[model samples]
Target: MVSIGALARLAGTTTRTIRHYHAVGLLPEPSRLSNGYRDYDAHDAAQLLRVRRLVELGLSLPGVTAALGSHPTPGAGVRDALLALDADLAQQAETIGARRRQLADLLAREDLTTSEQVADLLRDLTTAAPGTGPDQLRRERDLLELLETSGGAEGFTGIADRYRAVLADPAAVDRIGAWAARFEALAGVAAADPVVTEVATELRMLGPELFPGPTGSPAEDGGHGETAWAAFLASLTPAQRRCVELAGQGWPTCAP
Candidate 1:
């Protein structure tokens, strides 16, 4: 008979683990010797070795217990369990790979939040807008930055397509100019007006669709649409501001 400590050493496990296995019914409680110490015979040592091997092969304690038997079928069950674990691991690896690819795309455009495609679209819109100037260009840049950082390449790309369509029409420029004028007039009247606030909120909400971000309140930084718009307006010259102000009039609330 081997002492508990001796069995632990032979089985490459702790005495505590052996006791735990006995408590959990994974291992049978050994007979007590005259010295009040538990004694494990060859059968017990072989059972412990089998348990250790099953654990090393990734079988849970419960799984090992359920599958432990004298028949050759137990080996087949262990093999099947290992195969299932491998399949699960493979799935996790694929998911991790996909996430890494997405992160890589985001990192590559670190300098400009918007993708190249979205930036090109903004450039086209700026060029198409009536009275296009340095200020408008600057505004486009600011908007693109916000969209890129907030929505990501896919979202910015979606907005780019929409804006491109809107800008393609000959009459769209005048309409946009009129809308801008109206928005400026309203902005001048009351920055805190309910109507103005509602419009602003709507515009901000639309921004997320055009530029994706994690589902939450807008970032406290300049990622918010209103904040970006304010920056764009600040960058404009008085003449350019007037042009944008005219474009604001095309909005429904600002329309004549």
Candidate 2:
């Protein structure tokens, strides 16, 4: 027989844990000494060691209780509990593996947060239209994301679907690319610059063939659709936004 502190040291646990185990009926109550302190024996040490091992193996207190019955031995109950725990761990591992694979797929995308189908179409378009800068690519992605998430409502007029059909032809991709290059050239130019107004006015020639709809319907709709449209316009440069305002027939816009 030894003191509670010695039993704790031998079992790799604390006196407090041993006391808790006794209180919860996990370990048999220990003998008391003449000094009124608890006296622990080898049986108590062994039980505590088993309890610590089971807890470290992710067993709950109830599981530990079930595993170490009133008359515990090397029995089928212990094996069954371990088997159940193993099955649970295996399922958790599978779930974690699936989540990691999904994360890997998402991280692999250069155009993160853009819908997958739209990104595939954009990839083909970008390939056909070489020499487009990151800014142009990002803006186009933002537009595509907006259109896709909008659920093809009255605002976008299903222009996303129209773009899908048009972009399938390499020739259309080239034309869109060329127009984008010209527009991108005036990136930092003043909104009032003659080039800005000229490009804004000229957008009429390009809008129908490329986007083909009542273009400013989101602003006309007056709701979250309008807010989303404003955010997209706000993302553009001053001259780019000015051109959109000029082209979209009195669409209100902001730039910074």
Candidate 3:
């Protein structure tokens, strides 16, 4: 028989830790001696050592108690806990490794501006529409950026083939470019001008091929109130608004 202090020393832990183990019901306290000093045995020393080892292995005190108190099999609980800990550690290690690799790649590059997905989209667009103006390219990139938020990069991947086909056609690209320029020209003109009607006709014809199908009714847009659609029209100049309104009249219930 030894004193609690002696047992703690043998177990390589503090006397406070040994008392904490006893208080938590992890280890049974030995009886007091004639001198009113707590007497501990070799078993107490061994159990205290075990608890310290478990704590060092990352088990909480409560976890250590649960793993040690249960004796269904020979140290089965401890083995199970260790295995779970190992698995968690492995997953963390893998995540860290992946981040390290990404960091390495970033360091290796000098002129990396956007994400890989955005960069790929820019490359594909350039191939599809050679000699596209900077302003037009920037506008296209902005549209794609919106798609990136509304739909994921995968959504762009799905539509890339179709967009590439349209961009590859010189006539289609020319028409789109012309419409863009026309919108700029119509910014200040009167909505009821003869040219508004003519532009509306062109829009009604082009909307079918480019926009394809009814976008929404005049009263509602995308099941939401016409507020958003109204705002969109309000943003356009009077001539552009008139052209769009005329086009809508020609193809009522259709939107493009």
Best by lDDT: 2
TM-score winner between candidates 1 and 2:
2
Whole-model lDDT, candidate 2? 0.72
Q: Which residue runs of candidate 3 sit more than 4 Å off their true CA positions? A: 1-56, 60-62, 97-114, 124-154, 166-256
- Across 1-256, the per-residue lDDT of candidate 1 in tens digits comes to 6899999999999999999999999899989999899989999999999999988877789877766753377577667666876787789899999978867876776435555665566667667774665544555566667655555556556666666776787675665565455444453444434555544443443333322222223453334544545455566545444444443433421211
Collision count for each candidate, in order:
26, 0, 0
List the candidates ranked by lDDT, beginning with the highest.
2, 3, 1
The TM-score ranking, best first, is 2, 1, 3
Clashing pairs in 2: none
The local lDDT score (0 to 100) that residue 188 gets in candidate 3 is 66
Report lDDT (CA) for all predictions: 0.63, 0.72, 0.66
- Model 1: what TM-score? 0.49
lDDT of 3 at 125: 61
Q: What digit string (tens of lDDT, one per residue) describes model 3 on residues 1-256?
A: 6988788778788889888888989888888889888987777777888888888978888788788767589799999888887898899899999988877776665425454555566776677556666655665565455444433455445545556666678788778667766655676688767888887787777663442222345343333324334444565678987777777764533333
Task: State residue 24's C-alpha deviation in candidate 2, in Å.
Answer: 10
What is the model-wide C-alpha lDDT for candidate 1?
Answer: 0.63
TM-score leader: 2
Model 2 ranges with Cα > 4 A deviation:
3-38, 41-54, 59-91, 103-119, 142-162, 192-198, 201-205, 208-231, 245-256
Model 2, range 101-182, lDDT digits (tens) per residue?
Answer: 8778778898666555667767866766767788887787776666555434543436666777777787777777777777
